[model samples]
Target: MKRIGIMVVAAFIGGAAAIGGYKLLEPKGGDALSFQEQQNVLFASNPKVASTGAVDFVEAAASVSPAVVHIKTSYTGNSSNQRGGSPFDMFEDFFGGGGRGMQRAPRAASGSGVILTPDGYIVTNNHVVDKADKIEVILSDRRKVSAKVIGKDPNTDLALIKVEATNLPVVKMGNSDNVQIGEWVLAVGFPLDLQTTVTAGIISAKARSIGILGRSQQQPTEEEYEEYQRTGKMPTNNSIESYIQTDAAINPGNSGGALVNANGELIGINAAIASQTGTNVGYGFAIPVNLAKKILDDFRKYGAVKRGYIGVTFAALDADEAEKLKIDDITGLYVTDVVPGSGAEAAGLRKGDIIKKVGGATIYDSPDLQEKIGRMSPGDKVQLTYLRDGQLKNTNVTLKGENSVASTLKPAVAKNTNKATIDKLGASFAPASAQLKTRYRVQNGVVVTGIEQGKLFDSWEIPKGVLITSINGKPVNSSKDVEDALPATRNGMTRISGVGPEGAFTFNIN
Candidate 1:
């Protein structure tokens, strides 16, 4: 009986040990400490857990999603014959010429837009509804309405459209100038026909020029010009682009959509994307809201954009070019040529001068300068800081209107009586008669009696009967003034103003 009691006591001890092992090994809360207590104990022992936080886009998405809208455009496709030849002919050439041309259906495209006013004024990219025969806007609430284009500025790629609706959801405008690099941004648009998509990214860069505006002042090659003629989509020669670069996923349908900050304020208008597969490959660009605001204001006041021009051809300074120019830093544009009589020239900005700043804003490159000046109107006075001969200079320039020749200067008579022909200018000039000056109501000027073929004047389409009033903003009374006024450099650009057969004309010569 004592041996049996010892075995039973041993078995009882074994069962207790097994129960304790299971309690210790099993998950917390199974007769053991709670999970929270276990975590506290582990944390107390180690004291090193990651503390990363997540960015919640819910609030931003909620605020902006209602303001973003889907845009649908419809246009009649150009007939095959209108494209230079019928597609049936090409197919018949491969087979036999018995097939007739087939009629193409109307072309339809989709994009996105942002409401800018509570009264249903919308802003979008110009390319979105460039030639749309009909434009339809689908609001987030699924209300369909027809919209009409108010105004479009091709240079800035912005368009204003209006719908006959009231109390529309409008996006809050943010100061794009305050947007910082690496700041969180949200792109709200209808992408891939999906219900209002919101994409998150950071501002990768600012004041970026992607050459959507043609980079060179020279004439494009035959191929380039032909392609532009065929596609009708080449960047304008004087188009201004100061893009905000981001890594956001902006696809085709996202064009004209709102790019907002974390606070859900509109900062940019999604305009373009860099892609090889005809879709977003990460890189995207937006038009700065500040620039857009200027255009919008102009559109509201004027029937079209009243763009300001500085009248200077400039090149972006690089490290090597800076060293060559003896500049300490490559932070400003190097003025290659100041158009004669332009605001730049009037402000004493000489060729080879470095434009350091405009209106207190630092000029980093050509696009920066372009954006600053393009946003201003004619007759606006701007402060300019430039570097010339290693000395910094400041000047105030009164900008001129687009047609300054007819409005600004009085005609002057030639001092020299000799009638001379300028081979470089490709025109022969004679002093204007007093009767001719009286008829033209000019104080003094010269008349072009002859023009040579294959000359600048010929290329400008200036006929022999035109009067030469000024070259490069300088009043020219004689052929000598014309010859001396022409810059010695071949590649230099000049603006020649005179009265042609039609009216006062200004020609930009390179």
Candidate 2:
């Protein structure tokens, strides 16, 4: 059903492109075939050709069709099934909560992937196997095999996994940077459980963010949310503008699928879309093939995508903002804030520096800068030209991501406001695991696994991937211990602290 819905969307988005392909490619170079040749070609091309005739999509679709596949993943562990209730309660029971209780269950998950190499290298979304114990790929030929994780980048939501196989079908990638909006592209995938589904659309727009991050204060319009839909159909202005936006419909099962050009060359990975009603809204986003290649390189070399940072926050100035800033005829990223310790910081780059270009590519907005930098790893060096105090200046900055103290500032989303609720942090917590004892690694205090909407910790300022080192001045034994220690301070404020990428922070709650 999910796959089917995705397929329907692809058809709708591809409606015009498919029709266009039919009409434009239907005839061979406009050269009229001889009477006998016409009859032979007509019948041989399509079994049921309309009076107008039919375009042979076989060469286009078949050229890259077999390279697509489906992916399924499963995890091995009791935690998969355990509803991580209060660890304190579990502790009370575990010693003897009556050992006759329910046992933990196994966890299994599924997704899709595409073959990148004939040797069995498959690419898919990183979320598909971030923590899976076993990953399985089912090829177009219906052969299934276990795949090994090659590399993954969460920032880009892409993962590359490898299966030991021979003579595999591979999809050739095209230059996404060269693709233009309104260009024709096809989305090939197994949508809604349908095998080898194909849809079409034109690039609508490009480089759009869904505001999943709280960077911009402006609310995302329907068009703004199009990047996350993956319907393969969307509006203009939402795509990267660098995308080969098409009207072709895309859907859920179409994720990680192929978006190819007229030459049937893979250009982008069909990703998201825009829709208020959860269907195709004619808006979709795809990772540019060139950018994907860069991200893939990082994943293969570092096991994850590493984004280079310039430390300075930026925005492409519109005419209004440019006028307000007393600048004339400018289309470049306006610097907002230069992170104190980031790459931009060490280079003496200050806030409000208008970046004209990075490594020679014109940067018109933050997204452009992001895409450019994101395609690189920390410690990578690059040259930049910017306007500082109305003077055109040039400089270089080296990116860095492996922050030693980065684990100290991650936010923790929890219901407890008590500074001593370390025990409540339940879930996965790394860094500390290796730095601390094996017992302490698993016991790094708390890593809130799940949150209840109405729970007390729900109101607390908790962020994901946060590490609770210690609450108050005591050691944490279990979750309930923190709940019990939480001070009643809804009207009053309480102190809560944790660690993450930026270091450590302590704030008061209301």
Best by TM-score: 1
Taking all chains together, each candidate's TM-score versus the true structure is 0.63, 0.58
Worst 10 residues of 2 by lDDT: 232-241
Q: Positional deviation of 155 in candidate 1, in angstroms?
A: 0.8
Best by lDDT: 1
For each candidate, what is the lDDT? 0.69, 0.57
Q: Give the TM-score of candidate 1.
A: 0.63
Q: Write the per-residue lDDT of candidate 2 for residues 1-510, one digit (tens) a residue.
A: 999999888766665454444344445432232222322332232222121122445665897788888877666665542322211111212233333344443366455677765456677766556667788888888999999997876456667888889657666666566666666678887665577888766667666654322211112233422331222111111112233345687655666778887666677776555554444557666677777777665555566666555555455798988888777746888876555556777787887778888898887766677667766767788888888877888889888663411221122122233334233332322222222212122334554444445434565645444445554544443465445435544456545555433345565644
Task: Report the Cα lDDT for residue 416, model 1.
Answer: 36
lDDT against true structure, model 1: 0.69
